[model samples]
Target chain A: MAPAEIRNALASHPFLEGLPEKYLDLLSKLAFEVSFGQDEIIFREGDPSSLFYLILSGKVALEIASPGRHVIIQTLEAGDELGWSSLLENTSKQFRARCLEPVRALAFDGARVVALCEQDHEFGYHIMRRALGLVAERLRATRIQVLDVYSPKGVRAQ
Target chain B: MSTASHAAAPPARPVMEPVPVQIRSVVKETHDTFTLTVAPPPGDPVSAFEPGQFSMLYVFGVGELPISISGDPAVRESLTYTVRSVGQVTYQLVTRRPGDYIGIRGPFGTSWPLKEARGKSVLIVAGGIGLAPLRPAIYSILRHRGDYNRLVILYGSRSPRDLLYRKEFAAWGLLPDTQALCTVDYGGVSWRGYVGVVTTLFRHVRMQPQETVAMICGPEIMMRYAARELEARGLPPAQIYLSMERNMKCGAGFCGHCQLGPYFVCKHGPVFAYPEIKPYLDLYEL
Candidate 1:
């Protein structure tokens, strides 16, 4: 996917499904396309929270690693977003991402997007609101996994 | 061996409602915590609830916490929650009185192993204030004591005085085929009961690992270590279920404060089968 093709795909994504076609055209100028080979590492967990990517082709796995091990937390395929780190004010990602298969993605420059947001506050508002919603959903999922209430003490709850 | 007995067990219940509600009673159980009894605002009875489901209690100036439903589902007019004062929102809830206004959001998330545990023994292990989340299961099992086999509750706290519902535990034990056991990390001169760690208390009961459904809630270390012990005792991962907790804000699954891998404790579960969560158990602050 080229820059224009990547942006077109992103505009068609479920997240941006309801936006007007003109907005999609405006987005085309903001995206860049990149590709990765199978089993390639997309990003490490602690990498800088720089950019956001949308999948063009292939699959990516978001994984969490501890001592000598890693667990696949989520998988990304066509149209799914990667590098959601651009949303959080946090400096690094909480999970590492790897290409599960040969993949192509549309990348957006985080700084440039932030700049766009600063200039065009309306567009920035939509981006921030959508990004924040994603963050909220992910946070809820992480909480469930971390709080293991299913011990032998699986006693009743309030 | 007892498949015949399982067929006789009652069906499991679900917890979800769409009615508005208000606080009916707030009994100060501990110094900074209370057992909030919320009834349907004014008219209709509350929707049904299962053990392990939670509702978001919202205060005007403060926020909300996903407090588990602590009482029986048979009586659905009101729900109970034992909340401790840990943050600003909880402190507000703890300080409120009987008639004070508050918001109730859900009875969200999955229920415990009801039919799965039928005709099999139940071993409930809880630690600290974690015991609050497990209280409803205790009451539910005992409510239909004859439908199941043995019921054993193993609860632990920091100290003997820190135990919740002491008299109730004693009373639960007196019921046929039921027992209440407790322990602490350390003991004072007045402490005459088990003292070491909650995991050590697993030694006292005869847990038929295969047939028993182990429901546990406690700190991460306690659940991790306890699960190890139970597995060593012949309980496979499938036979175990764990309730997960995260910084839950919107019980309806909107907030990012609580996320564990791909599941939302506020939505998919606060209760998950051990095998389903075993992979991410060790992930830090995931």
Candidate 2:
């Protein structure tokens, strides 16, 4: 993708809404324009995570395996963020991320974003707030699954 | 979610019975444990409560739990409790600072029967941290010295250090009508108090079986046995009130986690008159 297109995409994300144009342009320059083949496994369960990516094209499937079932927890499309564990700590990918079709995403080393955020309090605040919201959403969704509201014995739904 | 554009308390309508409380101070009462003082929020009034009742405390990010009030009834502005950090949510609780908000949904459930114990002997039994819910009842009894008859409290702890409200037991015992008996499962070199289960303290308590009402709270195993001992001594099942703790997710009756038979502990109890719950609670896994 061209530099102008990269800048446009960054500006459109709700997380980067108030980021200055210069920083957005700089972020686009630093991002690696990465691509994947159709049906590619971007990362497997338990793999050490060090990079964060925002999809530029195509789709990615996030799934977790338990016993005989593989639950499709979520699907990520173009402009969606993935690989958040890299931002949290030295954590591994919690779920497997697979390419549904040929996909393109801008990937960045997690350390680079951490360093940038450390230097920019405004940017850091927005990113941390977004990260916490993301975590809360995941917690709520998993709780919904565990409670199994729709199951007959799980909850009466009253 | 910062407070600037936050939603109001989940109940929508204001909580009127028990005051909306805030954390005024957080004290570490034991290893990896804490005691919080919840004072009335700003202009809210203090809530009236009985000895055995409870309040639902909600912490953001973390979840909610049903905690019994454990402070003096006279000090209505701030309520205090010693809570062990046993789970993830409680771990978050100990870390909260003064002025941090906490949601209080109750003063729910039936309280210790001060009226019934007026003319007869009253035996208060507690095991482990189960004392948290029973302390307010103990304090209320002590506060109203002549309103009741003989006062005897038998409290059991895992060790010397775990006995809650260490400062108050002595002062309470000084009251003309009160007698506080504290025992532990195991005693250290410095431990001079009674050693053995709290039930052993019952052997020392002599009362007309039909004349006394015992409010008991503790581990399920201990409560069951305590009831057995009381029944052997001739106190009817109808006279023993046990504070039962189930995992309460939502304080409302909606959550099923606290279901024991058909009762929701969060709403219906966490406390019940003995006869009302004994039949179902005796059934397996109830």
Candidate 3:
């Protein structure tokens, strides 16, 4: 996509809804559009975190491989972000992200984005705050899932 | 002397008697849950019920259990119940065939606030079998579509296979001003819908908290979390309702078995405003 179009997309995204015009322009310069087919593994666990993603459309599953099974930890869809770990330096992915449907997303090089953040503290603060919100939301969801609230035993206990 | 003695005896309370109704049909909803339609004898129609009311079902040689009415309230010819075969009584109730007779008592308890919600959007949050109780309210709102604004249904189940009324959910989503979304706690490779707890889906839908009335069901923990999230989104406690379940023996307040705080769940409610029961909900071993 062209730089102007990328900037427009970033501006419209919920995560960056109120991002300043200059930052949108800066982030757009670092982002490139990417797409993947269904069932493709975008990144595997322990893979070097290279790119951060903001999903434009379709679904992806965050999963973990267990003995004889693959457990889906959560499913992210349009308007959701993936690969927050990429924002940190020298980190590896904790979960495998696989496309559950054909997906389109905006990809940003982690090192370049990190450099931009350091250069512009205000921009870095905005980005880090949103990422922290996403992490807290995911942690809350994970706790609810662990409760097994729908089990028959859980119902009876209530 | 015999005539005087007979005249002095008090009459038995008709409300306590179980009326025999024949099972019309049974549809297996999932591996463990079944929906049964029961009808009163010919020339006698079953009493109408508001959404969220429950009936005490008695299976001969087994036992009686309280189940929410899952059918449309407008259709008074028969009453429907969705039963999960988790115990001996529920198992026997689900296994009964057509032409079999089972006893049905009062279609008792409080109902969803459909009357108050007529001019505003209705938000339904159901988990697992909790959907069964809320299904009737959905039907009522759809039947009188102009009476309400937006209709949003957020449903969550244990997995893709455990979802109820799968086809109906698609149909509901197709209606104008209605949105239906389903999520599961777990998903297999082929499942493409939202995979998360019910609360996670709250952010995806837009609501005018002041103009919305929310009804929630499922396990107590799920309802507690759902209510908390709705409150965080600016909905008041009075506008939120939850269906509470307990070991109910008598369908009337005479039996103290179903007591929750100051109320009897069987008589006073299976549906209660959040604040009315909020304190009891968090009380340990209450």
DockQ values of all predictions? 0.02, 0.01, 0.46
Candidate 1 lDDT score at position A132: 80
Per-residue CA lDDT of model 3 for A1-158, tens digit only, reads 88888888899888888889889989988999999999999999999999999999989999888887777879998889999999999999999999999999999998888899899999999899998998898898888898888877777521
User: Residue B45 in model 1: shift from native, Å?
Assistant: 7.6
lDDT of 3: 0.86
The TM-score obtained by model 3 is 0.90
**All candidates in order of TM-score, best leading:** 3, 1, 2
Q: lDDT tens string, model 2, B49-148? A: 5566666677775777677777776676677766677666677777888988877765555556666667777888887777777888776776776777
Which lDDT tens digits does candidate 3 get at residues B1-286? 0001001111133667888999999999888889999996544423567888888899987989889999998887888999988889999999999999999877777888888788999999999999999999999999999999999999999888889888998899899999999999988777788899998889877879999989999988889989999998999888898999888888777889989888888777788888888889886555
By DockQ, the better pick of 2 and 3 is 3
**Shift of residue B214 alpha carbon in model 3, Å:** 1.5
Per-residue lDDT over B173-243 for candidate 1, one digit per residue giving the tens place of the 0 to 100 score? 78877778776643443344654456656656875778788888877767876787898889877878787
Q: Lowest-scoring 10 consecutive residues by lDDT in candidate 1 chain B?
A: B2-11
| Docking band of candidate 1 | incorrect
lDDT of 2: 0.69
Q: Tens-digit lDDT track for model 2 on A88-157?
A: 6678999887776688888878877877779987777767777777677556544433442222232111
In model 2, the runs with Cα more than 4 Å from the true position are A1-158, B1-21, B42-46, B284-286
Model with the higher lDDT, candidate 1 or 2: 1
- Looking at the true structure's interface, with contacts defined as alpha carbon pairs within 8 Å between chains A and B, what fraction does model 1 recover? 0.05
Which model scores highest in DockQ? Answer: 3
Off by over 4 Å in 1: A1-158, B1-20, B42-46
